[model samples]
Target: MAKELEGKVAVVTGAASGIGLASTGALLAAGARVVLVDRDDAALAAICSERGDAAIPLVIDLLDPKACATLAPRVLEMAGQIDILHANAGSYVGGDLVDADTAAIDRMLNLNVNVVMKNVHDVLPHMIGRQTGDIIVTSSLAAHFPTPWEPVYASSKWAINCFVQTVRRQVFKHGIRVGSVSPGPVISALLADWPEEKLREAKESGSLIEASEVAEVMMFMLTRQRGMTIRDVVMMPTNFDL
Candidate 1:
């Protein structure tokens, strides 16, 4: 039998690593052609070389306003149309608010929150015209709780949670499904800056989930029946407490 996503085209931002990379693999396995967007040209080239034509790499610095604004158009130029958008590009900022660099905080918020909104905004017109699409943002469990250690990071996710829900309501009539997958402490580079002790503790406690597991949830969301929308999937390792 043909796969559920056969003939679909998906665009995944931050596709060089972590959840984005894993999601690209899942999309390809489901028979969709995926466009891998990332700032790391070498990584994108390496992935594209292995994946062949099924994985198209678009080197993009999403921090550039011009680049973000023209993202949808660029994808359409490359793939002809977009059936799915995994707006998964982001950065992490942790530690107490006062201890964070002013510039670092700005960059984190821009990537985690602003860029997500712009990508969705840029793609909405096409999806609206087609009246069908799946847009999933990679959110965090931090959004749902006020984690004291990462105030800045958590705040960005909280903003995303609101954006996803509000946009879903507005676009459901147009047959566009907007949702977020909020996972807790996935094993990815986002945790690179975590205090060594905290990271070690979480690992020992089995509180860290693999990126592929989150991708599985994303696949489930994309494959759901048209009439239904898996609005928000909050997944965490069983041992994860918050």
Candidate 2:
């Protein structure tokens, strides 16, 4: 039997590790040709080596907003057309805003917020013209609830949540699906900066989810029947308190 995503082309950012890497695997497993974009050239090459020609690696810094402008065209040149875009690249700063370094905050926002908007903008025209595409963002539970521990991180996610919803409306008529998956405390590098005590506690209590679990949710969003968009998925470990 032909795979559901056979012949589809997907672009996944931050594709070298964690949720991004997991999502890339899921997309490939479902039979989509994948273009892996990341700033880590070595890691990108490593993943491509494992996946072979099915995974095309593009190493570029998403923090450079200019890269977003060139990304779609680059992908088109390499793959001809884009059918799915997983704008999952992001950075996290875990701390009270008062304690956060000004430059660090700017860097986080640049990657988390600005890059997301520009990536979506760059990919939209292709999907709109073809009248079909799926865009899934790796959002966070922090977006839905106020997070005292990381105010800046939470606010960035909230901005993306709103953008996904608004953009979903803007392109629904054109056969595009726009949504976000907000997972709580996933065991990824993003959690590396978490208060060590909190991180340890979550791990001990099984309150932290694996990156692959979130990837499964992303695939679920894309595999739905046409016209039925899985708007948002808020996932967390069963033992998680918040």
After superposition, the stretches of candidate 2 with alpha carbons farther than 4 Å from their true spots are none
**Pairs of colliding residues, candidate 1:** none
Q: List per-prediction Cα lDDT, in the order shown.
A: 0.94, 0.93
User: RMSD of each candidate?
Assistant: 1.0, 1.1
| Model 1 lDDT at residue 97 | 85
- Candidate 1: where is the Cα deviation over 4 Å? none
lDDT string for model 1 (1-242, tens) is 14789999999999999999999999999999999999999999999999989999999999999877878998999999999999999999999888999999999999998999999999999999999999999999998999889999999999999999999999999999999999999999999989999999999999999999999999999999998999999999989965
Query: Per-residue CA lDDT of candidate 2, range 7-78, in tens?
Result: 999999999999999999998999999999999999999899999798999978888767667899999999
